[model samples]
Target: MNIRNLAATFVIALFGFFTLNLGLDYGLRNTVPHVLQRRLLNRVTADVVAIGNSVIASGFDVAAFDRASGMHSINAGLGAAEFAQQYVAWKLVTNERTDIKQVVFGTFDYSVTNTKPTKWTTWHSNNALPFYADPSWSIRYGCASRADEVVYLLARRVPLFTERGGLWTKVETLRRYLGGVGFPAAQINRFGRISDSKLLLEQNTEVFERLGRSIVETRVPLVDPVADLLKEAQQKGIASFMVLMPLPADRRSFYAMPGWKAYVVYLRELLSQTGTRLIEATEWSDSREDFADFVHLSEIGAAKFSTRLSEAMQCAK
Candidate 1:
């Protein structure tokens, strides 16, 4: 074939490929995560919107929160989410609705302030970025290290490599619809808190030391974006609270690292300065039976912790 004909054919093929991928993304995005989230939000009409990584998603039970506080709640939790993704999810929810009276932001060792930008981008950028239109410099720079995600997605047309990729994501969504998964009351209750005292102490000692070292090595800066979002929520008349959810006893030690206590102190100061409420549920020193893992809670643990949390919020008022 002549050069002109070959060029024309290549252009046509490229157009077809781009069109096919765009169509797939459009369909899957709307059908999978977006649709599931929309349904949950619709049913919620929640006064308290719980936002965080899987810890919040799996740990906080909407039914328990409602029973405890008489406040309808929605758990907008994603596992392994960084501050950038949390910020994106928060922005998306708040932008679309105005009824959320409070937002509970969960903190962990792997959040934006503690991990590198590249790490943040790799794990959180794709699932989180769709919420904003032309994200600001802060968002861009915070995710600057994640340029590889862009390259990977563009080249491979895949974001996550789990069995639930592309169309398979819809299967997970359908399973949730059929009550196969999402937030199971049984799993929540089963894994909400730790029950073994000896295990708790033994685990925490090792976990805390490693956690401290991770913080020092990464030099993870404090994530100002979360605080800024809380401030915005307050200005809009929405109350916001920062909660350091209980990790398994061993996991809580990470906060005891050399500068860990100082970090929490700084966060508390920031919350105070911003007029946001801070709930320190990290005081698991005496509680051995309330955790399931270093970071997750068993059902009994969730119940106990939720009760304490509800009482604290009430007393604060």
Candidate 2:
């Protein structure tokens, strides 16, 4: 190609890229949910803050917990968040707040042990945006290598890179709406869509059984970011507890496995070293009607579970 033609093509590409980035930055910053999430992170002052992935987001009934415990609480859970993102949410929400007396982390099998940093291009990036936007934090907890650190640092400065997840979120939202158009309307709450929590132990029994067996066989170890969360909470004199959120009947049966029992014993020992209590609420709810899916609690279940959690906390105190 001619030099002039190549130059013109390059200029057009640059302009398009700049315009796309500008549009994405504006759209992501102004979205209602994103704005509200930011507001919650900055303004929420509660006696308790619960942080985790979607399980906590969809399962923790903040209002029920508040009513039952007579203490205000915020569910700072983020869908698809990993341990690093969960830690970031806690840090951002509790950074200057002295009113937060306790922090509850909702976890399931191997969640605490999975320390993989979220990708900046996927939907999960939205959950980790607060920390990934900061080069230092992204470097400290996100990137696994020097090359990754460089990319994270660059993504921190570029809206096109960092907000890719927001764009994907928009896409997913549209897809869900379209996909559900012909189906009966889904039951949704403030947390999002709810699945019918039925007590069908036979449904997906094999999947859960295999998952349990795999977990028992793999025996993953705890990672640094999770340990950091517990240690930091201890250092700040805030109570930190990791609750093993309710599981389906098929999944719960794995607890009886000898390997799984041994793994839990080791996990408890590690948690004790950091003064973090591991609360096993796995068998808290047995009925399938309490679950939104295989792992999360439905609205009814969330209310019931939150009340029980409040009682558990009171007894712990």
Write candidate 1's Cα lDDT for 1-317 as tens digits: 99999999999998886677666555556532355356554554668888877667666777777798988877777655556666666766776687888888876543435534433333322243433223542345344446744643343333232112445545755764688445543333322223322332324545556665555555544566676678788788887787887765545445566656755665666677667787878764346666555566666776776667777778765
lDDT tens string, model 2, 217-281? 67555776678888888888888888888877767666665555665676787788777777888
lDDT of each: 0.60, 0.72
**In model 2, what lDDT does residue 131 have?**
33
Candidate 2 stretches greater than 4 Å from native? 1-5, 30-37, 115-125, 128-133, 169-220
TM-score of each: 0.67, 0.81
TM-score of 2: 0.81
Off by over 4 Å in 1: 30-32, 35-37, 40-44, 109-112, 118-221, 252-258, 285-293
Candidate 2, 162: how far from true, in Å?
A: 2.0
Worst 10 residues of 1 by lDDT: 155-164
